[model samples]
Target: MDTNQAGPAAEEALARQEQETITQAIAKELGISVKQVRTTVGLLDEGNTIPFIARYRKEMTGELDENVLRDIEERLSYLRNLGDRKKDVLRSIEEQGKLTQELQEQILKAVKLQEVEDLYRPFRQKRKTRASVAKEKGLEPLADWVMEQRRQGQPLEEAAKYIDAEKGVESAELALQGAMDIIAENIADDPTIRSWVRQYTASQGILVSEAKDAEQESVYENYYNYREPVHKMPPHRILAINRGERENVLKVGIEVTADKIHAFILRKLVKGPSPVKELLEAVTEDAYKRLIAPSVEREVRGEMTEKGETQAISIFSGNLRSLLLQPPVKGRNVLGVDPAYRTGCKLAVVDDTGKLLEVAVTYPTPPNNKKREAAAKFKELIAKYGIQLIVIGNGTGSRETEQFTAEVIAEIGDPGLAYLIVNEAGASVYSASKLAQEEFPDLDVAERSAASIARRVQDPLAELVKIDPKAIGVGQYQHDVSQKHLEESLKGVVESAVNHVGVDVNTASASLLSYVAGVNATIAKNIVKFREENGKFTTRKQLQKVPRLGAKSYEQCIGFLRIPGGDNTLDRTPIHPESYPVVDRLFRELGLDVASLGSKEVAEQLQAQDAAELAVKLDVGVPTLRDILESLQRPGRDPREELPLPIFRTDVLKIEDLVPGMEMQGTVRNVIDFGAFVDIGIKNDGLVHISQLSGSYVKHPMDVVSVGDNVTVWVLGVDLKKGRVSLTMRPPSGNDGGAK
Candidate 1:
């Protein structure tokens, strides 16, 4: 074995070690086998998408789902970045000629970038600071004498020798002061002391905040004189405090016990009593207060804020996914209304297939109450298109619009007519988007928004994909989180939702298709272009011919693309092209005809067979076989249809009408950390506090209800002046406080 190692060979050895460590670490953290992480990493390295690996390569990845595969990908990326950072730190330290073997080992063993940076702090090049100036004045020897702690003599004697008038050391007192600066810098730069102090402060420190101006009232008034332990602050509180601080409404600081921190530092540096102990104590105090305290507070707050943002982003991602996957109100002629007082309500009537039949304006409510004219126009449009449902944008004048629509339906006396208010948070954003302009070049912005609102009701996943996920407004503090991370996470959720509900290639827009696994924006646009130049895609194989859609991309994306009522019956299902043979074999072995797929008898027959035996005979994995069977049983099945539909209402309820203990059915508009906001046909959504969510303990609001969930709630109280309603889901308990 060569004692001295360098260059590519040494790099190879280190790379091998790092890779092994990453593999084991990811496995341990994710509670999966190391082999699973390795296999998944290899697949990802080969350009395999998460959806592709999760669905097509089940056996290879030990049957990991898309979420798990994505988690592995995320962790692998982070660890690889950490490894690269460690290598850079090592190189920087080695170049400084200060890298010791123990230091090298410590740096190699460091798990986080923060730890590596801490170890590198001492050797890091600095600007001309007091410490650097002292070192220039030859006071480093005196500083070393203080650190050694073995000599029982005064440090001034040692510091006196370093007093050179030429290099700015004028007097013994100035020399001692210069040495003190060096000693303080050394103590501050020591990785061990910094790490210990940071951990201790984080654990014991109290985060305190006061209102910048207590007389001024705002939403954050509750935080005017708030105090919470740094480590115990919840994610929502962290975000709240951050927002308050940013708005200049609060003064926030971390309060640590100075006595404890000083005692710990003294015990570490001031070993047995020595004459330099007092000097060391003074230097330690100087190091903590002047050099380390501010940075440590910032670092702790940064870490806490990062964790809070991660949590908030995760919640937003989940809510967005749920909202996007809401069941499509198919086969209903929808009338979309963009409510406005000044501009009049923009109305778009879209037929069952989301084709815009007409666009008109209604002044039923507001500045121009053209009741007779607006009602007549609305009635004519409804009768012309045979509208069965109304999709009202939950925007300006929404309550008035809802009331007007309810009256119109009552006047029409149609039993089938009803309305549902859909969250139009990002409709305006989409209307202003280039994609929306390209889709409807002839329409105005508000007209386009009305059309979008209608189409979203028909197919949420398809239409919601057009708007920026951040603008969707499904989560609290979404704007406060890391935008890059939030976008990536919400993108993943969209990708997962899209793949989960395999899209009909001919029907999906470019925005929706872009979220499909292995499909980029360019390819998605090319798909639409190809479909336009050529006719609709009749088979999954047609995707391979699209420009820039190479064999690999096609293979990764084709399974999630469906072509209903196409030439090949299997193409109407999620049964992949490669798996068609297996499916054909399954049908043959079961003595069933493919033409009669999705029929009750055929579905029963397929469901009755043994999937394991069929997998063996078909030579496919059990998971793949089961998926094929599911598709065969119900071709083009939508998972969303099983969820509770949005509450359809022919009548509108006002805040004044809400009485305590009045039970009403409503849809969950959004779920946050503390509780859920339910739309009980009012202008303001009611808050169902976490305590009112259920009879038992609720860890999180999302665990009980998600966005678009239909739940029956009892009104605990109504604040008419404030326009707020308190709702409960625990059967009310017949009390004003609601249920525990």
Candidate 2:
């Protein structure tokens, strides 16, 4: 064959091979057939979104789930990049006129991106370096001698005589040493060796430590004496070690056993023996010291840090999701107080819908001489607004503020009124944000914080969605992750929560509406604009008139929007607009109108009548229609209420008040790999270690409990100096009632 025709045929064969390899990798990762993976890749290459593929192309993909589809999308990007780099490498080697059958075959058969890059590195043009300088001289022949030690089986001194002394090869020993240096640099630059070392360190390396010279006593005493495998270390310990290294209290190093790694590398690059065996051994020793050791150490640390960061981000995402879905205490007028001692307390009152009614200051705590006057003003505001609840910010004087509210309610004697201590973790952060400034431009930062406290009590989900998820303070190691990854993961959590709860179309703010599954800022603003231009939506069909809303967007989001007084009964229910025809057919089959099937009892009566008969009449499946019927039975029900109501305490206790044998109620504040931290109204939270979680052995804290769980714990021990509280879920003495 001529060169041109042969070249095209060879290229076609190589491309086919690359495609087959990628298809196999994708099929293995997704647990699907190779044919299915090929079809999915073809669709993805044509610019289809994951949601679209998973929803519309079930037959082609064999019903791949969303997670599997996302994986395929990511793998496709990587494979395309590999192909682009391979073409560039072939062109560059051809330009240099060094292309050969053996080299081209090796490149084509390479499985990993790193292996391809390694084969192409020597052909790549670059700036001056130690190896380049040595090669520029007549020392290339000497370097080749060092590389051939295993094949030639020659002594190092005999190989050194071939180099010319005029080109800086002064003596036999000097030439051998210089040649060793060149070979060491080559092995260090090998991408395959670096990749292997990275994997090895990630799996088996340990982070060991010794104390620093300056600091004698530090918080990292345990880490200073500890040696943990890099992959097995928990996030908390990793963060602690990083913090210790930053403070110069410890000298950290990654310790890897050299024998295992050295043997592995030698097996790859060195065969039996030849004339140049002595020179190759010297080169290998030089490579270990000059190139491999430093590179491997750096790669190991980087991998450890990245792994810790990923695990921390996963934990933060879970906690933030739970904190956002906390149940709302809706439709009750609230009074919020930002308590203080040196400064007067800032108080704000909002009506049942969170409209600011009044704002004032009070001096009800220490250093205030007019406690009675403050008490009188509080009572007057409560009676005027008919306040049903009091929200106190859990800050400096939170307990004292709770006591003040309790005393006032007792004197007035209203049994229906109650007070709650709200978590104020991000109240200050929100108070200073641009959103807060726009909402309350004239109010002081303190007053805005007080307003947030009141709004949080009325609707925790809606108001909390306005603030950043990270600032809510439920995570254990949030600051250690990539900020972009953390933000995106937490946004997913908020989106899930908002869609699951079903927002109120008439009352939701733009911020809350933006979190709906398919809605962005522009769409949320359009919803609000439509609400303002035309009054409340009487029917969901009106949403179609809003700009930028299409069929797909409406299909995903309409079911989560609740209209209170719509034209049809299903408008108030979670049934999507597309599903409304099926529901109408259902009502027609029962000989009833939408108005007659309003209550759960009536809906159940209709459902008890034969779904298969209704499905035949309606031309729909029994499964979908049954789901629509259930949704119609309870329109706009809050799912958060199905969980336990949040626990609010009237008093705060100190660590000294707890005894070893006493049991107390506590709320879970954070969960880590080793244990859970519980807030039992004490200055120091108690730890429920993993071993004490249950009778059976547990591997992770998440296996037993999660954040916001309420449990009764028995105090096992308290170390006053260390400020550590140990707690157990096991019952004390003979009072066994199963684990809580």
Candidate 3:
């Protein structure tokens, strides 16, 4: 046998087995067929983007959404990592000549990385533990003798023969003690015993926390003396306690009975016992208390932390998706205000197409006291630019800015003129970015931010894409969660949102274009540069001429990149170029041309046909045909238009103006675990606790509400001192839970 060839062959076999296992595992967990998982894996391995596969290759994946595809991708990566770690563990154990058939089987069948680690713990190299020291003193045989309990002799007399003064076994008692220590360490290292102990401790443990300083007043005071069962603790409570513990404001620990765990271990490890029952019982107790108990408690706590973080990340990403998908307030000029206290509010007038036409500064708030001058200037700007909307940053002096803008609109008395306070979380960061500098070289940072605010109303997806999603700030504990995990999940949300609302190739910036199905930053820039050199992209095929945009890239991205008023009308729709032949065949059969698309008569005719029959005639998948038909009818459609638009305020309200039972329309600004904060046309947003979100039980805030939802809420109460309002979606029952 050629040894080199055998090694490569074995590796190949192992890889095949690993891939098969991962495929089956994903199929089971996701409740999909193995064939679908296998096909999806093939597509992913071929370097297809998630959005492309979701939109274009629906038949191959059985019409799974982008979220599921992302889940598959994440699970596949995790399984591959687990597989590699198992290989490393198996090799190390085999090299030490301790790998057994049962151990190998257990390692191979392990699904989670933690399970594999647990199985491998026994073989891992130790750092001079009691067992290793006893072994150095030649106490292993005595320990084995004591464990079997079969010998009809005194254990200490057997241990006395191995006593060596120089080796630290100076007496019979000392030798017996060393033997018991070895026995205890051995029991702790046994994978079966350790697993049982961990499971028992977790099920029976009570998680408790205490205040480090009882007199300290802080946000975590509620968690200072908290107690919950380890199994029933909620994710938010876990996260709160963890944060308090990290801040050194609380001491947290798990309480489990040591005796129960020791008894369990005894039943598992000891059978046909004889004279040494007392010795074995003591050894088992020592095994649990001295080693396994503390280690397992820490592992349980770590597991809880992981669960909490995962829940937080999921909620954060879900809220981000909702925030990004807000409807665009299109085809209107906007006056954007970046409110401030001292330097004056920076204002920018943006035209319908998001071009900055003018910039100004006005200080209507205190100290500046330029309300008269600012009102006149704002009125002039609104009339001069034909502004239909006003957007004020929800930062310092925002309420005053909004109040002033509303008064100016009232004076003009245009019911059509409305103002909205937009969350300006990352405006400053985006303004200082290199991309922003290039977009507005002459404008100062605050002026650029004002322009960004205006454009964000024009298209939230386009403008928000310019900033990092982490900075967009529609999340809770985002900083405390895993940065890498949060970034990856949010990136997926952004990509899904961008692809959901296809971009116009001629109008989209590099930041927007980069998130298209197959487009990247470099290629996105290349597309722009190509447009600059070549004027406008008249057709989808023109994209192929751009540098680094190959056949695969074009196939993936061309369907998502729209071209309005281009030479080819079909290019304006989302129909992929590859399907143009099928479209032409249908239209030709109907005695019509593509030029007649979007007409009311054509839309009715297309809608009247049977989708299944037409799909068969065109030799296309049913999903693809339906999409083409929809796109042809409504060319250049944006998905955001179907969603509710952000509620605008023609007048502003103050905390003092609110009263219980007052019904008002609001926009959901942020949804956290406890509740959602709603912007109710006031300076401060009000809280709608999860219990009050609806007249039913709520699992979490994300279940019933999302960011940017336009809802009708009734005020439950108000605390003028704290500047807080309590709200409920359900009819007022005259009950409220004050903000906790």
Candidate 4:
């Protein structure tokens, strides 16, 4: 097995060579000058933001788009991690002082992380083992003699005869056995064998299953009858299988056919004479029993974990995007209803600012014969409160409640009062949580749920941020990922959303405050506490008095905190508190008060004029001054509101109702590697495969559509028995414009 041949210096040289080759490859693919690539790489190594670099250093990058810049950033991270691992391996090997010429050459020639680690394994620190004990007893010479016999076609017994008893070599048979054990251990530790096994398993293994020994019923029935190739298994299926395994409803195994691997390894390691052949066979058998099986299992598990994490991250990103984009139902008194069957529906009425004004209960669903009375009660509540919007929880009996609300609205004949089905995925989780109990001790759990639905309608971002991201149910496989990574990533998404759409400081909840950039839980609480003690913040400077809110935190967070009626006119704008002086300079240059600039009509007038003239007069960059002038012109504007509203249909069709060439209005539910799934009022979301996503060829589904986006789709095919609906984004006949 040539165990003593590969080492660290060789590996370092190989990695450096590979890195240069990859860099050249990337430069060629990106169609950029080599110098530009190098400069971008260097800047990326220094930890610069892509947006900052793209916007501010266009001369250096030659105006690289965000996609190319992000690609470079991700690739650079991988290469840097690889380089760090190489260095660690080299240091560990050098400390062992096993710097042989042959070993150095082999290590330097290795190309992958797995190969480098394999070469370093023999010298790597390990726990107490049989081989280490044999080496400690001074049996290395005898072991080496036996190994030589395997090469020379000598009998094992003859090779074992020269062993001395006192040094732990008691008999010829025992000596030969000890030597064979060492040989097996060394062969098993060989990097080549482990690498080969990993490749074979990844390419060919299947996750197969059988029923558990005990009878059990589970939600994951599909996995019990399923088998999928490891490389092709979808993320959701993997999560389902894992969840089933955790529940002990199935016994899962990663199946790798053994004969093929055995033959491959035998051909690689057993090419010498008869004794050597026998020893190689023994080692191969031992490798499978002692090393190969366990290693293959670990590798499969790790692959599954990686796949699961990627899927989970995708799901989280999609959910966060949807939550952030949820439409803000503004300027209306909203009545939220959490409907139930056994228990009556819990209702809460909140005004435009989302302060709870009333709470009640009613039976409006099945198992209740008082339907007419329930209708009367709903009309009385809406008329009494002058409610303009009805937010209903899309939980149990949601459709029936929707029908009930529609009937009541029909009788009132008021088209102004419309109903929206608010997603209540995490509302239940929040209602049962400690925070909910703390905030509304007098309210029952059902009432809390109603309040959440109402608050979401008032401002989706603010209320959705209160619940854990994973609990927000827009994901496909959230439970399969690392919880800590998922939490951090989703938190970033929430913070980005909150910062993107500036929050009203006086009206923001502590939960919403926590998502502001640079504001931790403690600072958020302190801000709320200060608000309670000192009334509304009259000026931005008053924030400094809040405990633990230092200058740095204030600088990062103040721009996003909107004070509706502050002393300084710029305090209500998105301009940072530190940038107040810049706004003052602009005001002085324009011969205008800050209040005069805070009107949309005035902002449009400023934008129509020459921005460069304003910049030169104010002594700032044209871009910076233009941005400031725009912000001042339309104070407290929400960026999200500029995007189009989500379209809902007056009528919905089921999967069974879908016919070929039928047009339907649907919202894209998920965009994946292969396709986009649209929820066209069907239990099973219809698939618009990548081939059908656009008229032009696209390498990825994201090129056309993203989650939460609404589009018109044609029903291309339907298999009702199979519960599958195939859809296409292409318009039917000669209609170039889409249907909605």
Question: Whose lDDT is greatest here?
Answer: 1
Across residues 1-740, which tens digit of lDDT does each residue of candidate 3 receive?
11246798886886787798899999999999999899999999998999999988998998998888988999999999998898899889988889889899999889888789888887899899888899999988888888877748887778789889999889988888888888888788888887887787778899999999999999998878888899998887888888899999999999988777777888876776577778888888888888888888898998888998998888889988998898999899999999998999999999989999999999898779799999989999988988899999998988888888888989999988999899998999999999999999999999999999898888999999999998988887888888998888888888888888888999899999999988999999999999999999898888989999998898889988999999899888878888889888889767777888878999888888787898887788888888888888878788789887888789878889888998888889999989999998888899998888877688888878889998888898999988989998886664543221
Q: Which candidate do you rate higher for TM-score, 1 or 3?
A: 1
Q: Candidate 4: worst 10 consecutive residues by lDDT?
A: 644-653
What is the C-alpha local distance difference test score of each model?
0.89, 0.76, 0.88, 0.74
Model 2, position 121, has a per-residue lDDT of: 73
Q: Which candidate model has the greater TM-score, 1 or 2?
A: 1
In model 4, the number of clashes is: 6
Q: In candidate 3, residue 424 scores what lDDT?
A: 94
List, residue by residue over 464-557, the lDDT tens digit for candidate 1.
Answer: 9999999999998999988999989998898899998888899888988998888999999999999999999987888889999999999899
Number of colliding residue pairs in each model: 0, 11, 0, 6
Clashing pairs in 3: none
Estimate the TM-score of every prediction: 0.97, 0.85, 0.95, 0.80
Would you list the clashing residue pairs of candidate 4? Answer: 5-103, 7-103, 10-107, 10-108, 11-107, 11-108
Stretches > 4 Å off in candidate 1: 1-13, 733-740
Least accurate stretch of 10 residues (summed lDDT) in model 2?
A: 731-740
Model 2 over residues 429-535: C-alpha lDDT tens digits?
A: 99999989988898999999999999986778898888988898777667766788788767767776777777888888889988875677899989999999998
What digit string (tens of lDDT, one per residue) describes model 4 on residues 444-477? Answer: 9999999989988678888888898889876666
TM-score of 3: 0.95
Ranking of predictions according to TM-score: 1, 3, 2, 4
Q: CA shift at 596, candidate 3, in angstroms?
A: 1.2
